[model samples]
Target: MCSGPEADFARSCVSSITSSGQRATLLTADGVRIEAARTPRTPPPAGPAGAPADDLVIVLAHGFTGALERPALRRAAAAFAQRAAVITFSFRGHGCSGGRSTVGDREVEDLAAAVRWARSLGHRRVATVGFSMGGSVVLRHAALYGQGEREGRTGAHADIVVSISAPARWYYRGTASMRRLHWVVTRPTGRLVSRLGLRTRIHDRDWDPVPLSPTDAVPLIAPTPLLVVHGDRDPYFPLDHPRMLMAAADPATTELWIEPGFGHAENAAGPELLGRIGEWVAARG
Candidate 1:
């Protein structure tokens, strides 16, 4: 956790720079236009003894029913921006982005675009922090793109990966929250409610070939540092979810933090925890 003064400085810096984020309209491989905002790293405090400027950039991926301007997302971005530049974007169908959500399938492309944008902005070191549904997308995207760098294929790759409150497998309905989420994705009436209440449009079809699960993607994230954070008290997924992800990840390069009393996603994340996450990413760099 950060001290009172550091926390206040972080909030103040973010408040002043949040509105000045460089707005970007990124087009995914499948032609979806994703609404993204990149808040450049806050300038170091004045004076020779001030903190050094950071070169790494952190890309934040929000969960279902979340947008770039969502309060939780903004708070997380601010915390990260205290240590590095931050990019927050809306997945298709969530905010002002075009196209419907295919849940986690096509969302991988959305993350890819954001990562590319980060690299284009002159930051060679990039890290991704995702929550809930966004968490799963990070895993899959890393597996698909990160591996390409080692295999001589071309694509955007993240230097580090952090997944919070993510599920290891798909089609899980073990919890009431997940059950409700399934209803929202599978039923027309529930979809209507999601559209009207959440402004999220669900794709009417199922995954064609069934995209790889988070567990399947975990093994492929080796060589790139991975962090798995989950809450014991989360209503959406049980302990088994994070456990499965950790088990599949390369133990030598992976870090696992099972918070005792945390809940789910960005909503449950506090400024202190977000500050800690920024520190962890900086340490890796």
Candidate 2:
């Protein structure tokens, strides 16, 4: 949502700054290397004797062109860590991760890998919080992994899913930002600019069989709590996208939050909002 020269400069600074955490190199099931970081939860004040530490982990899936090192994502991680341990990773084709971005498709494997990693850390519960393109992936990931369909890796499923600023369907050119994004992924010159300016490597081939759309995937996420969040002023996707998702989900378990003055994804998310999201995960995940 940021624009103009000042916003550009601020974005540059935020992207350049590195986040502090325990760094690790992860390999997805498809054999792609992923750059990841884990920020341990901040221990709270002493409580009753023999009370256990927080056993929940939040796996953060950043939007397109976002990375684990970006300051905006780092800040979100820090905020969430106050309530639970946080895991942030760069999707393949972004940051130092290896592989061309399939946009949203195939990214489910990446999220699954992160969720499995969370379980390996001895966490009793795993929550997925995704933004923009990541938002769609979380929905699909929960649907795919929730049913234990992929090689019986039921361990990869998320206990809870949070999607923000995600589109409902594919090939939507409803907004200027989305139109420009399509150009960037579909044209050679635009891809070059994206590589040099955004550091995001996109795949050239189109989807063979278009994967399930976000709205269609929402219904399958039932039983496992789902939260759909969108900004009133998001330039990439409109309010209708969230509404469609909500309509597809079970009203009994799914929750929708329409942020009043929010913009888009990680860049728009601040400490207060991130803190509230963390609290929601702790209470519900």
Candidate 1 wrongly placed segments (more than 4 Å): 1-19, 43-53, 150-155
Segments of candidate 2 deviating more than 4 angstroms: 1-20, 45-53, 149-151
For candidate 2, the per-residue lDDT at 228 reads 91
The worst-scoring run of ten residues by lDDT in candidate 1 lies at 1-10
Q: What lDDT, from 0 to 1, does candidate 2 have?
A: 0.85
Candidate 1 TM-score, true structure as reference: 0.90
Q: How would you encode candidate 2's per-residue C-alpha lDDT over 185-267 as one tens digit per residue?
A: 99999888887799888889999899999989999998999999898989999899999999999999999999989999999
Pairs of residues at least 3 apart in sequence or in different chains that clash in candidate 2 = none
The top-ranked prediction according to lDDT is: 1
**Cα distance off (Å), candidate 1, residue 140:** 0.6
lDDT of each structure? 0.86, 0.85
